[model samples]
Target: MTSFDIVFGSFLVSALRSATPLVFVLVGETLVQRTGSINLGVEGQMLVGAMAGYGAAALWGDPWLGLVAGAGAGMLLSSVHGLLTLAARANQFASGLAVWMLGFGLSAYYGAGLVGRKIEGFGTWRGAGLDDVPVLGPIVAGMTPTVLLALVVAPAVAWWFWRTRTGLVWRAVGESPEAARAAGLRPIRVRLQAILLGGLLSGLGGAALSVDHTRTWAEGMTAGRGLVAVGLVIVARWNPWWVLPTALLFGGAEALALRLQTADAGVSAHLLLTLPYITSLAVLTLTCLRDRGQAAPAGLRAVMDR
Candidate 1:
């Protein structure tokens, strides 16, 4: 391959790897929002999930188990948000903030012992039979299972929202919980289910970061990816299909930043690292200006207006 080809290929690979966790969290947040609920605590969930996942992998010597534990940890934390909002009738924003703080503290306390620990995580695909195929084979062989799963989940979620009966009901609840109640559907139950499912996926995203991406544990390692996912969800207009490309855009920015840093491009390392967040902020601003709540679920709009 030529130098240009190598460079381009490396960028593509890095982008895909970076995009994997975002895809999971973004899709999960989409579902929660579709139920007329917002989760600002995703960062906390991801952090706890990362810690639990890494700890599980180390204790059991199995990465898959770690993934499950991570998911469970996230779901467990999300239940607190559900209780405060659904049962106690607390403010969604306040509840979400509480959840975030709780997750942050819990992860830091629990993960302290696991810091710097390593585990055998998932490996890239071999594409053994595709060796004869050409460029596509080599590219496919480089992806880990988590990356492929993230790719599948985006389209699958889109299909579920548009094609399934349950999905329609979920959307209905999001648009108008009162209407759903009048229609004999249980809005609270549906929202709870959405919260739990979203938590499961968010946890999986965290697990992907620790076990599949970093293969190690650290406190607050998720940085602000969860918040970024929340912003991207709005930019996507809560559409699962749109999430794929939006996530890729962020991932590309992140990969580019890393590449530039490695190349010693003379830019401040701190500035380069901020590239992804800057991209997210800019895109979110433009999207909000252009759409102006035209596409937001009615329930979400009501919650935000309060």
Candidate 2:
């Protein structure tokens, strides 16, 4: 293979790896928002998940357990948001921010002891017999199961939403809660379920970040990928099927930043790290301008309208 092919292949692999966590968050938030709930606490949830997952893995020497603990932690936090928004009828935006703060503060406080520690987590997946092929070979090989799982998750979620009774009910709750209630569907109950499910997946994404991707814990390690994902939902037009490409778009930009840092270039390291955030902002701006009438769920749009 040519040198350019090698470099591009490496970049593609890195992008997919980096995009895994984002994909997890994107799919999760997509589910939550589809139920007419906006969760901005993803950053905090991820942080807590990272810490909890790493701690569990360290304690039990089992990465899978760590992942479960992380998901549980996320669910615990998201439940608070659900209670406040659904049960108490609190402002959804305010409740989300409160949850976000709780996650951030709680994670930082609890994770202080676990910082700088490491544990054995998931390893890379090398597809059998693919290493010998050119170009596509390297790109397909060396991916972790987490990344591969995310690849499958996007399509699975798309299928679930487009072709299932439960999925239809979930979407119906988001589209019009009143109509749902009249139709004998409990919108509040459905939203709670969606939020819990989203939290589970978000926590898994967090675990993937600390336990699988970095294999270590750090305060605020999620680094706004959660918020970036909020904008991506808009870019995706609220369709689960679109989440994959949008995630890869951000992932590609991040990979480019990493590659640029390794190369002999004039850009500052700090500036290089901003590539992902900048790309997200640019995409959000363009998407908002192009699709002013967002394809958001009816409930979400109503909330936004008020």
Candidate 3:
């Protein structure tokens, strides 16, 4: 291939790698919001998952086990949010903030010693048969299993939301919890399930970051990706399918920043790093203005209106 082809192909690969984690978190948060609740603690959940996943992998010599640990850690943190919001009827925003703080503190304390540790994390797939198929083959071969999973998750969630009985009930609860309750559906139960599921996905996102992408642990490594996921969900208007492109947009910006930094393109390194966040903010702002909350779930509107 030509030099330009190689460069462009590399950029695409990097964008996919960076977008993988966001895809996971976006789907998870989408589910939670669909149930008329929000988990602002996604940041904390991701951190805790990262620490637990890396620590477990390091201790057990298995990345799969680390992934399980990460999911569990994220779910465990979400349970606190569920208790506060569902059972105690606490302010959702306040409860979510508390959950985030708790997660942040716990991960930092437990993961302090894990810094600089290394593990045999997930490796890229080998496109043995398709290696000669040009750009597509090379990109597919460069992806790890987690990247493939993230790609599947977005569409799977979209299908589940629109094509299943359970999904309809969840959507019903999100649109009007009182109506759902009167119709013999339990809103609290559904919301709790969504919260837990969301946490699991968030954890997986964190694990993908440390075990699949970085292959190492670091404090605050998530760097507000969780918050970015939250904004992307808004940009997507709660539609799982839209998440794919929006996430790729953020990922591509991040990849470009990294490429520029390495090429010493005469820009400040710190400024370059802000490209992802800047892209997210710009898209989110535009989406908000266009949507004007017209697409928000009614149940979520009630909670936010308070």
**What is the model-wide C-alpha lDDT for candidate 3?**
0.89
- Model 2 per-residue lDDT at 295: 70
TM for candidate 1 is 0.96
Off by over 4 Å in 1: 1-3, 126-133
lDDT of 2 by residue, 1-306 (tens): 898988888888888888898898899899889889888877777777878888999989899899889989988888988899899999978888888899989999999998887798877646688776888887777788788889999889989998999999999999989999999999999999988887877888898889888887888889998889877988888899999999998899988898888894889878989999999999988988987756778889987768
TM-score between candidate 3 and the true structure: 0.96
* Cα lDDT for residue 195, candidate 1: 85
Give a tens-digit lDDT track for model 3, residues 1-306: 566766787788899999998898889998899899988898889999999999999999999999889989999998999999999998888888898899889999999999988798887756576556677777787888888888898999999998999999999999999999999999999999999999999998988888888888888899999889988888889888888888899889999999999999999999999999999999989988998877889899877666
CA lDDT of each candidate?
0.88, 0.86, 0.89
Query: Which has the better lDDT: candidate 1, or candidate 3?
Result: 3
Which candidate gets the maximum TM-score versus the true structure?
3
Error of 1 at 100 (Å): 0.8
Model 3 alpha-carbon miss at residue 186, Å: 0.4
TM-score for each predicted model, relative to the true structure: 0.96, 0.96, 0.96
Runs in model 3 lying further than 4 Å from the true structure? 1-4, 126-129
Residue 234 miss distance in model 3 (angstroms): 0.8
